[model samples]
Target: MSTVLTHVTDELQSIFDRARSVAVLTGAGISAESGVPTFRGGGDSEIWTWRGRPVTELSSAELIATDPQLVWEWFDYRRGMLTSVEPNAGHRALAEWERRFEDFTLVTQNIDDLHRAAGSLNVLELHGNIWRARCLRCASTFEARESPLEENPPRCLACNGPARPDVVLFGELLPDGVFERAEEAAARADLFFVIGTSAVVYPAAGLPITAKRRGARIIEVNPEMTDISFIADVTLLGKAGELLPQFLKERG
Candidate 1:
């Protein structure tokens, strides 16, 4: 991955200098750099397996409704693991980027709060945070700082009803008003960056494509080539932790 072509680098600098608003989209790869497991791929978490089958199937609304205890157990295990991990270089750099630019928008597909933990402000979470739970009856949110609840499938104290992790699960729609803001940011950005995402996931995937079509200069940073690589004006092929800091030093 030694091909850091000069012409592409120069174009990126030009875009950075002139762009009025910038939008960034991050995926599982960024958090993976911080040792957070990617649910579906090679870096998938070991805790997601139950009786030799992946517990990921339980991360849906139907499962939560039918077997709430199982769902809570899975989420509790994940949250415990998240508490031990720290934000990596990529997360730190993006946090710094948020400070440098005035009209910057960050949209992430990850459910972990690593971006916030890294000191990034005003981030839009396409998938809700794993550290939070929402009450179905009361429509209130609670943050869990400790480990799993003593009661499997914690209840909402207010309504004494069922509560589940705030994340958008399988066959569930994204939370109200998040995707709209992401779309608005993508459409309005003068510079759009697709970082660490495969560009295959929908709604979120469409943001970069929307930005590209709207005339924003697209810059992609990933260790491997992604679907959006072909459309990027500068495809910096490397890990986000390695490439982002270098890119900032050279062109931030």
Candidate 2:
């Protein structure tokens, strides 16, 4: 069962009141609430398999190069699964925060575009979006949202070369300059919200500590204790969808 949230204390309210600049980092946990299967799998922690191989193995630059068709097929199926998924309350709350704060940044580890769907304009996707594809030959990139794309391993619009999902694979580095932007935002924020992530994945995980070290207050929102929970200035334990809306309501 999800943990029940206690009362929103005066100290907690003060933290929100004192913040002028805010930055938020989100992960698969937030998207999972909207039915997106997480990288570590969802509620059951079952690894998604494709042709007897874990999907994680298939999600690599090497695999995409060796068998582009197989990679495309798997991603196409994944896209179809997310076609009807909608942004939930947690997503909307962040979007509202963006409008409320003059300097707000939303950095996410998810490839899902739910943050943008929820009307957050200042999102920096650390992982490239799943709905976008990159050209193999010319290295051009574009959005290709057609579920079960007309052509498996869809052709690049700029070049006839085959396309691959524009995501940061197991061994691939983050998209160019994305991490730097997130770092700058974290450093500049007066309040940093680490939501729905365990903060175990490095690089992305290190962002919270960066903000904390820079003298920003760190607020962690998750259902269970995480690796970085000890460092959080305020740790709100509950479902993000349930807690975030309540948080905004209390702040108002």
Residue range 77-143, candidate 1, lDDT tens digits: 7888888899989999889988878889999999999999999988999999988888878978887
Error of 1 at 146 (Å): 1.5
- Each prediction's RMSD to truth: 2.9, 2.7
Q: In order, what lDDT does every prediction score?
A: 0.82, 0.85
Which 10-residue span in candidate 2 carries the lowest summed lDDT? 1-10
- Tens digits of per-residue lDDT, candidate 2, 1-252, equal 222245456677677766888999998889888988875834753457877888887897788879988888888878898999999999998998888788899999999899999988888999889999999889999999998789988899997888899888888999899999999999998899899998788899989889989999888888776877888877788778887777566443
To one decimal, what is the Cα RMSD in angstroms of model 1 from the true structure? 2.9
Could you tell me every candidate's TM-score relative to the true structure? 0.90, 0.93
Q: In candidate 1, which residue ranges exceed 4 Å CA deviation?
A: 1-11, 42-48, 250-252
Cα lDDT for residue 22, candidate 2? 90
Worst 10-residue stretch by lDDT in candidate 1? 1-10
